[model samples]
Target chain A: MAHDIDTLSGTEVSRTSMPEEKRSDHALIEATKSGDEAAFGEIMDRYRSPITNYLYRFLNDYEEAVDLAQETFVRVYFAIDRYHTQFAFSTYIYRIATNLAISEIRRRKRRRLMSLTGLFQSEEDTQVEFQPPDTRKLQDTELVEDERSQIIARAIAALPEKYRIPVILRDIEGRSYDEIAEIMQLGLGTTKSRINRGRGLLKEKLQHYL
Target chain B: MSDEDLQNNEPVSRLLGELKHVEAPSDFDFGVRARIAAGRPAEKGGFRIPVWLAYGAPLALVLAVGGYFALNSFYSVGDANVPVVALNEKANVAAPIPAPSREVVSAPPVTKPDDQLVVKKPDVVSDSNVVAVKKPIAKDKNAGGGSIDLASRVGRRFHATPQIPAKTVLDLIGAKGSFEADGWRVQSTTPNSLAERSQIQTGDVIESVNGQTVTDKSTLRSNTPLKTVRVRRDGKSVDIVIKN
Candidate 1:
């Protein structure tokens, strides 16, 4: 395993420990670009979990996160020939995932607008379809810890997207500020400000916890 | 003051660290493989409709349907100014042109080849308001009185009455509505007018002409036959049928 301390945000960009025989992402992509299924499979195995987890934090909804993550890979697989190796592969894929998440958010908004009248038409419709995820799977932690965790998730989710993306990428995923800036297509100063603003918002929301 | 923020920033860092980590479903890799296998045909730019076209097709379909109906109804202008071609009246003895009331107007039962009769009968529901007239024909001067060959325009909206000469060109534009509200409001009717004969009143609110909701005065076409005229009067709806 190799690691680099990211001074921009003062966090570590930890590389995944790869096997000796493991091919590089760009190499696998090149092979896949030439129609090699095995190479593509190797690429998929390498990044799926991180991409999925990234999306999950961004969306705050597991089902939608997973769907968008899968869509991100599908897009990558289709556009492999166009994947320039000048940029890091992780940054490239994370950019794709971020775009997919933004689109999903927009879609949810449009859906809400389209059927706003339906909300009051039925009492059953008032109830949210995606219940705050079933915490039943977890062992008995303190009620306060579970509640605090949910509050934090909600607070993070509620942050304005400009703040949310940078904050999550920096704080939760431990991504470097430069990568976050590149993934978000924003200037580094702007990215840093957004993360700070997001943390300020979370701090305000979790005032009692602090 | 979290200015030169560290990875450890009060509660935000601790909270993020403690938040649950989610992994891709176990079947995600298999799903990806299956999708790749299924989507292989697309690699060659095979059989897939371009993204723009896929979305555009439905929008185009809706517009096409809307345009067809709009154009069809547009050209199918109802005969608002329908001539009274009374089948039962004698074809020769032209009755005087009539004007009586806003609802139904009929002149005195006077017969003349050229006099316009004016009379009033009932509000609506009356065939007595029809004033039949004969179209005068001039026999050919070269031939005898028993000859044909009376000349006429190519097309005209109103048939020739004994009084007025037939028009040559089609007046594409007709009279606009006098007033319009929810639909068109009947401002006034000519004495023995087509609208008056159809039992429409000055105060009647014309809701929809034919089946379409009336927008403004521009939508009224005198050439098209009035199939169904729904009107709102004194808080009640009344439908008038004007047959040619």
Candidate 2:
């Protein structure tokens, strides 16, 4: 019930009245460590969507990002014993999510290399052929804006991971520099710098369309 | 375009707005709660085994027994079994008959030389076919002549085997794995170029490229060599090509 109020939009909402909710992250963490499933669940319910969105933006693939987000929660759950109240709960969760994302990216890269070989071989042999679907008729009904969205998604994908992550967090997720730094475990200056650089890279890559 | 104009750009604003509406899956809350429930540890006052002793004592016993059996099995697997039996047999033979002292046995025997040399090396010494001399090494001048240092011999034997060099590739373009919070990551691979062609489907773990193990995406991008790539796909080995 307390989370219902906290979930409302705008910065002016008061947090002092909800005593149970007002309990510091440390209290919830201590309760969770003592086998209090409800407290743990409360934490999960509160953070899950934001964390999922964070990962989704970080990783363009919806399904994979969702899976990693779930794994991040699972890890957080299991590592509850190791949770120190010294750091913000957000930082801890973000660190776990970021690690999983990084691992997934590495795995994807390896797969891409293997797939590239298959592509080349298939191209040269021509025997292993895949027929292209007829797109002309479909294109007639599709909106021009929808096509533009597809192009933009591709352009975003084309940007290197370095530039991409900050852009997603800053622009797409609309997180402040302080939040981004905490999530990324970087200094405030570095976080801002990355956002700037990321935007520059995106602009340059998308300049052709612009 | 000016900074002011860019800030008010409709497309950018629209994109950001659209991104905000990207809701998590319907089961997201359920999944998270389930994980949290599963991960919650038992209460300290709750009826449960002590965490350390529960794991520690059994682990210690296992290591001790394991070490004993491992050493025992390693040494006892071969001719050691036969010698142990032969030693037991010799003890049985010596038990029944009192053997004469070495001084008396060494005295010039009235019997034939063959009968005098009855104290032969035990028949159980079948390991190397090298005869075991019962006398002290100082008395046996032939001991040093035929004996070889086992360590030096083994070392020399392996020295002849050629060492295989690890190969590496450079200048590959791909996402890097990092622990850093703000690191970039690949969101998805659209059906395209090197990624699609290489049969690198989603969720494949890239262990290395051209024999070079990559730590991060930058390392992967910079160190990817123009040659064959080695990757693990579905827990199996796969090779990919990198066109020069």
Candidate 3:
């Protein structure tokens, strides 16, 4: 319900005036550690949208983003006792999400290589099952917007991983440069340079949009 | 903020910021709670050996080790089957004589008279069948009256004979085999040579050159013009004069 407001405005809205919303992330984690499950739910509510949006932009695949986002929360839930408050909770969660996304990317590359080798395999060796295809209709304007969004997503995905991550955190997710540096375990200067480089790359790829 | 901060607020950054933000699906909370309830799925695909390899590798290693020991034991038994005769090399004995399927017994060293050579057979320790050769040529003058012992080569399989010492004089004279304690034991004579033409046969021992005793080191005799050669064949002395 809270996420709908943020989605409609295309910006982060203020938290609702609920008792859990007013509690700091550390306070909520403390509560969860003290056997308060609702506190953990509130923490998820706070991070779920941002983390999902971050992962979706990074992967350019909605299903994978949602899966990774859920996994990130699951990790946080299980490892709550180990979560240190030295770094901001946002930095810690983003770091975990980044690592998961990188692993998924590498896995996709391996899968691609295996599929290439499988090209020589006989047709009978491959099991093919029929499934019904999508039959949803799209309006003309919606089709154009969808195509543009796909092109932008492709350009962002095409950037080298070093640049892509920092650029997305700064520009799309509105994470501060210092927070990006802490999440990446890189120097602030290095993080900003990568963000600039990523933007330069995206500019080249999306020249028509610019 | 650094100069990089100014670049961050540029048009491309602005364009990126204007891009539509995505929120988690409505059922995202349900999914997380479900995953928590399920605990974690067993992790997949980290350093997993294939099923075939896990079994096949150890089997191949065991087979390799077993094959090595098998071959080693087989060769050891084969070497044991053949008796190795170690000679008393100090006595200037000839190389081991090949004697198939026969055990050679070594008699005690016989006392020699001042003018005769007493060739003693070396001590024989046989593990199977036995044969005895007492002593060789007690009356041979050329041996300088000292006894030498020899080991017999004993095996069930046909063994390669001891290599004959190369006698340059005998080689030039178209003969093979060594000059023994008694005389030059003629093992073979060259075909169509002077030795063959004179009807010199194998097993014939040349006892003298014109009745003069020649020792094993007799080299100058090869250059001497052929005249008469007395040979002992089958224990009888015979004189054959060469047609020079």
Q: Which candidate has the top score in lDDT?
A: 3
Query: Could you tell me every candidate's TM-score relative to the true structure?
Result: 0.49, 0.41, 0.48
Per-prediction DockQ = 0.28, 0.15, 0.30
The lDDT of each candidate is 0.56, 0.47, 0.62
Q: Considering DockQ, which of the candidate structures 2 and 3 is the better prediction for this target?
A: 3
* Candidate 3 structure lDDT: 0.62
- lDDT string for model 1 (B46-115, tens) is 3545556755776798799999999755543433223311111221244324334233222223345554
Q: lDDT score of model 2?
A: 0.47
DockQ value of candidate 2:
0.15
Tell me which of candidates 1 and 3 scores higher on lDDT.
Answer: 3
Q: List the residue pairs that clash in candidate 3.
A: B103-B131
- Output the lDDT of residue A78, model 1: 80
Question: What does candidate 2's lDDT look like per residue over A1-210, in tens digits?
Answer: 777666763333445444544566677788888988777767776677777777755655566666777778778778888888777887788778877876666555434334546324544332212111112322212222355554455555555566556666667667667877887778877776666655665565556555
Quote the positional error of residue B17 for candidate 2 in Å: 4.9
Q: Number of backbone collisions per candidate, in order?
A: 13, 27, 1
